[model samples]
Target: MSTRTDTTSQAGARAPGQREPTAPGFERLDAEYVLPLRWSEYRTGDVLELTDYLVRIAPNLDVTVVDGSPDDIFAAHHQLWADLVRHVKPDGEATANGKVAGVMTGIRLARHRAVILADDDVRYDRPSLERMVAELHDADLVRPQNYFTELPWHARWDTARSLINRAVASDYPGTMGINRDLVLELGGYDGDVLFENLELMRTIQAAHGRERRVDDLFVGRVPPRAAHFGRQRVRQAYDDFAQPARLVLELSLLPLLAWSIRRPLRLAGVAALAAALAEVGRRRAGGSRVFPATSALWAPAWLLERAVCVWVAVGSRMLGGAKYGDARLKTAAHSVPALRRKLTRADGRPGRGRRSTTSRPR
Candidate 1:
């Protein structure tokens, strides 16, 4: 039960806490949650939760981490990715894929039959991974849905924001597994896109491949810090650039609300109905209970914030900004490099001046 042992095997077999590597020949039939890991000083409870999940799901691989550092005993799987230049808020433009770019790039190069990308933010059980892999049997790409867990007061304020997102946008799960070859054919994900997963799926569909959302099985992500969550209203609004359909839906909400304001009863009815739909979505987005009915109080705030943020995003685009996140909000018209090439093929890990190391935060 404790994964705190100091010793580990020389051959890079998994330890109690470390995740098992992808099976040889890249022929794994089951889907696993792939975490492209960076080092962490995890709390005991967090570590224990992660440990239990890994141990209980051994071989089944509820989760897998792509380690950049060589400290872990199970470091061989770290070799799966070529060192690219990874960085947390890199200097040039933080346009690169957030966490899993390296893993996705590695899969592209290894020509792996399949790989799944999962970030450390989410809270989920092992069965969710099984559902995703099962979905992949018939589709080229599969994404799960996510809801916020741990409704810190700030998260409750943003609850409606997330709900509106679920209603209008195609849910880009906190994790996804896809065929490497398909990614290669689509030229990989557009690294600079604010919504890389959506961009990835859009490219896949453009190529005439099958893609689907496994909605019944859900996952959860850490609630954003209050400050970050506020900025996220605008930042993610900018991300909708990739999902035009959602973008249009979001845009329509403003005018609908404006009209509803002229009729208080009608406005209240619509708001209440939408909030109920949001709660329904939350229920379906499988995860432990956390949302408060009172959280729905923030739905109006979510609507107003999205409306204003969409304008901010559009204004930045008009000003020629490239991508958005971390509130950099800079404007640059130059194009970024291919997502695959960003992860350079050197030393099985990154070489200096190529890319920086990954930083683990929400």
Candidate 2:
């Protein structure tokens, strides 16, 4: 484990003290694969992935950035991560990237004993790696939680999905304290990168026969207010009614309530009513009462976004294409299979984009 030290300078620089990184202890295995992102440009609503990367890992550690200013539209750099990992030398100890890139970076860089895969939007109070190092003592994996500054509606959706994933979706051994090596042993993230973090956690549990653990420092913050509200409509549209079950079980009644009106009007009325109720429920559930009017206006847009996502999801799968973010989705697109195979290879095979695997930690 690393040791922490607190140091304050006369110039008003306060470096929170932490255990000195056991870089020396792990010196024999000191190297790590690092990825940092600075995007070229993206639409206002599309930069969360990049923002998430900057906020999460930049303060605590150095990163490896791609040379040019990359655009932020997800597809532009979707496979860029896979290309970057192949450039990492085997002597490197670990690797990490943000959003899709970070996961791929870590998997490709896993030649040594330790690898850290993290969400880049989170901020650690101190140098982040120490927690992973200490937990690495007997644990196979370590992951952190998403700590939000002000919970946005989109963040709430993510929270719901994450909670469901952790609390009830599935079970695996040693899942409480997730680790990189354990993830490798489980055949890597299998492409659908959306839930790789959970996948890694599950993989660790399966390999080490224990649950993954959480640390005190793993915290995340919400996006900036401008970004939050500006993009809120799009995210809500994409998320809120995307699932049939959520629509049928949770929101279906709204349209029925407003049915006599025109279709758009009915949907609008239902959306407004539902948003109000959800706000009330949120307050009742011990959340803040600070609801924004923009949130109400955006609710209907999410209905449209949800419809599009559902259509896309269904179409993609039906046409032998997996959902956009899953590994199998890549399989349907010929370019991804070769890259995926390269990104997930073990045994030092020089395959581009193949990932390396780790043994089960005893």
Candidate 3:
């Protein structure tokens, strides 16, 4: 890890009173391939626990925490983690989506070719972390599956969403492993998009980079507080705007429900079909082992919620955009063709626009 300190008066620079990072007691593992772990967060609640986690993984991987918290919180984090991991702030000119700025900065600073990016809540065990890093050698990106740990009611409710996603396709996880060179090659993805993950994935696809989605590679994630989960309903729905087909399907749901209201049997059949689909998703990719069976039963309810929230998300769009932290972002994600044009123009080469291939674990 680089010990060079930022001398510029930038947000990520060490505060005057902040202590310099100390050499910790743990010994680095003698592994042929070790990746850096980049964790991004604006404000974190579980500071101590997360520090402990960083300590546990310190020997196996280089870790960096790109924090964008207030001065007091930043100082506190530096105090706790400076000795254990690289703790820094987001760059002063971060994108509208601050997390992306942190991600970009972390990747730029990583010592390894491959790096793992994660949210504050995502927790990786040794085996899963190593597997993701190893898999990245064959593909440009690796997306692992996330399941909630210590499920609350809201957690259970959200698990239904994951199950449905898994049934139709792979679920979008909080953490991903990517080859640093690929992102740098593309000049970093657009940071203003609402669905940042999808934006990154699409950007890779636009550049004809290979992606791997490990459906059975389960990583534990802490569920958001109930109140936080409640606030995310419409915002989460707004992400579907990135996928026109899915957005169209969600937008038609309410009207379909109203049309079927007069026919009880039709409504029952629709609900059953939703549940059945969720069940199939629950069983796919060894999900039955990690996800609860009852979560599949919540599919109809979750779909109903999306049916209503999607309209609200549309309304927000018409009014300008949805609130993300302090910024209101309208665009969910750019189309692949648009990104391909942008990339081609950037490099002065005809973009191949090759379709991305997914490598699933057998």
Candidate 4:
């Protein structure tokens, strides 16, 4: 094993530990790879500086970068993209990096067995990548764990959210490894989705397919800047429309948390219970220790922040349309008073018959 990171792409870029199908512990089919990255000008310098390293890890990788920036910025990376050994660019546009672009890129690799959808900045090595590929054997899509090992205060605060996510076996939204034909057959991701990976995961699950969230397969992600956290948090909460149950649970928890604040003893007891649940959920999901156990103590604070964001997001959506970069997060669909389907008539009347009727005041 080498301690050094290779920053160049070559024909024979080595994938150590990516084993043969018959190799012990390697049950998945060894298939060719295609990667799609969504790019913009703001992160161009940082992302391109590391793409070479990405190619070294997947030398045979068919990497395509879909740019959402201007023509000039595209030109800047054009030569570099040309020089890179493992990138494929057939069509280009600024679709804001959602299902549309993802499908476009995935379409190019439809002939291949697998398509790896990723952000422009995510760089992973062979071992982690192999684990991800292996994990894909069990399901239609696999979401690898991407986290920051060492975190500052802002990231640790964010960590509480991640720990709770494990309770639902929620996939990390930054990257996806999906079977190509399945992606095509499933009609790709939902259009106009802000959280593309999250939407895709749920879409696959909704279709009666299994989605695996791989905890053993991990990748390092640069912690987001502190200033961006609140805006990003709000935007993410807004996208919780894709998972209504989660939104409902999060929304419902807020009132209880607030009420408990007036009673110190109750709040402590609730916090203690939440902390224990968080710990158990994390371990069960095979989550990393990136989220400190002590951080779970802030579950109330996390829930309150999310509740505020959800309200603001709902209000913004109702009042006016939201632009992607704007700090006021909004979704096209109104999330407040979430619409849940119960067995009932289309005319808003309760249905007749024992199976369809509801039981009340029995």
Could you tell me the lDDT of residue 182 within candidate 3?
Answer: 81
Candidate 2 lDDT by residue in tens digits, 94-138: 222124344545455545445544433334434445555555555
Model 2 weakest 10-residue run by lDDT: 2-11
Q: Which sections of candidate 2 miss by over 4 Å?
A: 1-112, 127-129, 150-178, 183-187, 192-194, 205-209, 213-218, 222-312, 319-362
Tens-place lDDT digits, model 1, residues 207-326: 445666665456767775578676666667877665567679888877888888999997898778777767664554442254556665677666677877887788877776534434
Off by over 4 Å in 1: 1-32, 37-59, 62-100, 109-112, 165-170, 252-270, 279-297, 322-362
Off by over 4 Å in 3: 1-45, 350-355
Q: Where is model 3 poorest over a 10-residue stretch in terms of lDDT? A: 1-10
CA displacement after TM-score superposition, residue 54 of candidate 3 (Å) = 1.4
**What range of 10 consecutive residues in model 4 has the weakest lDDT sum?**
353-362
- lDDT by residue for model 3 over 209-287, one digit each (tens)? 8889899999999898899899999999999988899999999999999998899998988899889999999999899
Q: After aligning candidate 4 to the native by TM-score, how far in Å is the CA of 329 from where it should be? A: 9.2
All models: lDDT? 0.53, 0.38, 0.78, 0.55
Q: What is the TM-score of each candidate against the true structure?
A: 0.64, 0.43, 0.87, 0.72
Clashing pairs in 4: none
All candidates in order of lDDT, best leading:
3, 4, 1, 2
112-136, model 4: which lDDT tens digit per residue? 5566666644656556667666666
Residue-level error in angstroms, candidate 1, position 275: 1.9
Top candidate by TM-score: 3
